[model samples]
Target: MQFTLDDEPRFPRGKRSGIGIIGCGHIVQTAHLPAYEKYGLNIVGVYDISEQAMRTVQQRFHVRHAFASVDDLFASSDIEVVDIATHPAERAGLILKALQAGKHVLSQKPFALDMHTAQELIQEAERRHLTLAVNQNGRWAPPWRITTQLVQQGAIGEVLAVTHLFDTRFEWVTGTVFDTIPHWAIYDYGLHWIDSIHCWLADTPLTSIRAREYRTPDQPMESKADWGMWCEFVYANGAHAMIRSVGCSQTQRDGHPFWLHGTQGIIRGSILGKGNDFVELERDGISSRYPLKGQWFPDGFAGTMGELLCAIEEDREPYHSARHTLRSLQMTLAACQSAEHNGEVVPYEEMKR
Candidate 1:
């Protein structure tokens, strides 16, 4: 297909929207900074607890000012939006503070550590009437988008079963090289896949979830486990989906890592591979690849930011609003609870309480 920059949507020019990026980490360097730069969103300031980290990002991105803390960023007169790129544990508090400061927020996934906090954050945003969104950017990824389009277009007929397989050998144990963060496996990497499934399937609230978990001997942290999890989700429409994440697997595959079996066809995709790596739409004897267009990091981030800004400008909810993202968070937490209870099926409502 022909690629053109003009085909992409343009943001309103000369508006000078100031964005304050908190958390100078991997995601900030790879995704957020490049995205803000692409959309022409004026990054009025940056913040991180580490002075050295702040200096690194500011020097790399040429951002003018760097604040010592989130509080300082919130107090900045130039910043209009606060992008929370911090770890999952700190995300809720930072986001809540930003919202209270009268700034819009776009945050990384797992929005909170658990369901209760996720619900509380949502309520606060609604109460304040602020534009709160989560960075569940995988939905906008070309392969998943194409898969959803085909499924919705009935190329897959009636969807029967969905199977997701996410396997990785990267051991994330606390107090080790991979143990930089508190929670390992599921919350870190698996959350993205869970969110992608929920988003791609039209934000279906899981009716019930059953799961299982495992731990490895090398894992040092008491809480950290080399997990093998399986979650069975019964959607309201009666569609059944199974998601499995095996950290003990020998292979290191990534992304959504899933297959959808419908009455007439099957659609498959992965989020963690190269060109044409995530495209598998086959029905009858016909099949074709859906290639990802445009650049990866900046393009994906730019698309998300554009949608968010447009939503704010129109007083509408962005495509992946907090309310929608919360369903995925609920699913992830429900799966964790089910695994803790020996694969006992846990209903979504019960998990909330």
Candidate 2:
């Protein structure tokens, strides 16, 4: 259950990235805190909107400072970066405040409520000469990471289409704060898969998207959103990526798998969720199998932080910076709009508002 990196230091005492954490929610406890510990990063302090939550996190994680106010956390000279784990509603303001104070920020996604807010945050970060990283950690899932590398290496001559299929009951919603999230399955959880496709097909720009969200009567009407969702994404190169997932199916267990077809080869695999998964590439009647190591939970979390560390040291943007992940946000919002509009085929360009 624990995934922290090392009891021994990887760098000299003063050399690791100095991080000030700005949220103490579920993800911070499960993923971010453990990943930071594993990387041997220097955590300067911790803060939360709730005074009690802030104090609890400090004690639980052995954090150095339990900041009295958001401004107090921002003013820390030892804090060179802010790792923001707040919800989308609050994330933009926190990112803006941190950038204005001259601190690099790594934020959770859906990076913003909408694309315009995301752009505003990105622009301010650029103006301040600070890196604004989007924690699209799901891209580091072993199956996804390997497949992306394989396609880039031309192991697949030319991609034709991609299909991602997932079926699982979001039973975890029964007693958690996520139980209250509107469109909990698609808007909240589905963003992970949508963002992954953007990364898996980095070369092709998505041009069109049509989507729908639905729920059967048995599903809890916790919010005004659906438990089952579908989307078809089209690229400028005439390629298509389709996503079909159901999180409220009373007849199904959990499954996460993907299929990718190319002119010269075919790829099929499942993400780390099922534990027993494989990536098989078939070409010219020959089959090759690649096994994956590390689950997405903490490993992907570690990868996100590691990229930011490298970006800081090399004076460059992380591969999935806030500006870079704007594509994912735009696509996700299009899906939402399409579902609301009765599955109308919405050109991705129509979302530019």
Candidate 3:
């Protein structure tokens, strides 16, 4: 079978949109800078709390300027869009500031510290007519994104169930702030799949979620976050998605990480970063396999900035618009609440209200 990326990018090339970045963290160093360069946008300005961090990214990525402070970066007349890659705790303020400054934004998720803050930032952006996008870049992961296309093409008939089990101890924990957060091990890392599953369903509205979270006894005791999460998600259209994750698994092997069963067909693949990484769609007793380019780590980063830039050019909302991702945020938050409430099913309607 011909191997095509999930979708052809319709972003207009030769259009250099001015981009400013706020955080010079791990993601900004690895994915965001490379992706911005790859997608035809230049980082006109950047800011971080540490001058050293700001200078490092500035020189490393050859970014145009390192602002003395975030306010200085925001004040730059060249910057039209601000990429706020700061930690979740700091995101709301940075996002609200950018929105009020009349600049479009692509902030890191979980962008909201909570739904109320999400709504506040969203409303501010809306009132200003500025595009605010969450970097739910998992939607661009090859295997997951490809499966979405096949499902939408009716190759999979209708998506009935998508069960994704990720049972691997993420080895990249030691020297970061992630080691400290309570739910960071589960909710933080697990958010990719949470957001991706929503994307896989093609943004069909969600209805409710029944979720349970706990720490596995055998799991390594590192973070305060639960090491496991079993989520049963119900969509408004009657489709369902389930996520069973063991973030601290030691002995188990996660061979096939995802199984998406549809009425007419099914897709099987692994999203274990940099792992044959193929999306196999089997329908009507025939099987076809499509290969992927790279992991979501860096490749997925492309679409985050690319979509925002294209939306600016097209005069429309980005594919990862903040309004749309607000549902994903609410679902995740409701799942958090439900986990706290002994796995009680949380109706999204109640939370949205």
Candidate 4:
């Protein structure tokens, strides 16, 4: 099914908004490209360091222009929005460059490799008065959206705790041992869970985080062993949350499981493998099951993108603003740091200051 904002009156009416994409990697092919196509936006150009990858996307999407350098893509006058899907380590510099060029940016999560850099990038965007957004798309998953609504309506009264578990069994025989695999799990998959948790508990800004990380014995640092991580997040209103992720599960299926418990009710959901998606909400001892629906963009990407377009056209902050993205990023990065330092609880104030 295609994704279009035409049905939403809040979205702008023009199909002429041009979008340029940097990095024609896996996500670009599987998610970003499809999203742009579904939205009916003008994809004016694409750029990647790898010539073969660039050619592959250009041919597959029938995009008219392809550039070997990001510089060239940013220099294009026709490209109004820039999507940066490059590695996390390179995100800050690329985003700054894009913003400096007077273009709106939609970047992959973990907006920066670290909080300091993320702050700098955010400040730059604010200074330039440009739209800067991160792809925390998991919030748009139908199940999560329903959960958000239920919680907001007090179906889940005064959320007390949230437990999120993401477990994926990577078939070692078939998995690629890329050089950046060590930073893969947390930066790649963990961001989705973290972002989703924040969305579910909107008023909570993680106050303190304590975490632990584990890695397999046989894996190289680059392709580190299946790692598992657990983190505790404390909220300002005395709410608490626990997030756990395991990169290598002996279990045959990949499951990103979530259980949210509150004073009045509970919501349980799982995104497992390709077809095993389900959401169960329990309120007042009456349980109802809702089949999950996956959208064209990950979870929150499409809605956030549509909101962003409206914000840009109408001169307002998008629903998922840079400030929100930064808070999520700060919490995740602090978890990583806390884990590395032997599970010491890191305070949110420390990350900000």
Candidates in order: C-alpha RMSD to true structure: 3.8, 4.5, 2.5, 4.1
Top-down lDDT ranking: 2, 3, 4, 1
Each model's lDDT comes to 0.72, 0.79, 0.78, 0.74
lDDT of 4 at 140: 63
| Span of ten consecutive residues with least summed lDDT in model 4 | 1-10
Question: Against the true structure, what is each candidate's TM-score?
Answer: 0.85, 0.91, 0.91, 0.87
lDDT of 1: 0.72
- Our model 4 lands, by Cα RMSD against the true structure, at 4.1
Candidate 4 is scored at a TM of: 0.87
After superposing candidate 3 on the true structure, give the runs of residues whose Cα lies further than 4 Å from its correct spot. Answer: 1-10, 202-205, 236-238, 251-256
- Which residue pairs in model 1 clash with each other? 255-271, 255-272, 256-271
Backbone N/Cα/C clashes per model: 3, 1, 1, 7
Ranking by TM-score: 3, 2, 4, 1
How does candidate 3 fare on TM-score? 0.91
Instruction: Give, for candidate 1, the lowest lDDT window spanning 10 residues.
Output: 1-10
Tens digits of per-residue lDDT for model 2, 59-129: 88789998888899999999988999998899889999999888999899876898788888889889888
Superposed Cα deviation of residue 251, candidate 1 (Å): 4.4
- lDDT by residue for model 3 (247-280), tens: 6666445433898888878888877543546688
Better of 1 and 2 by TM-score: 2
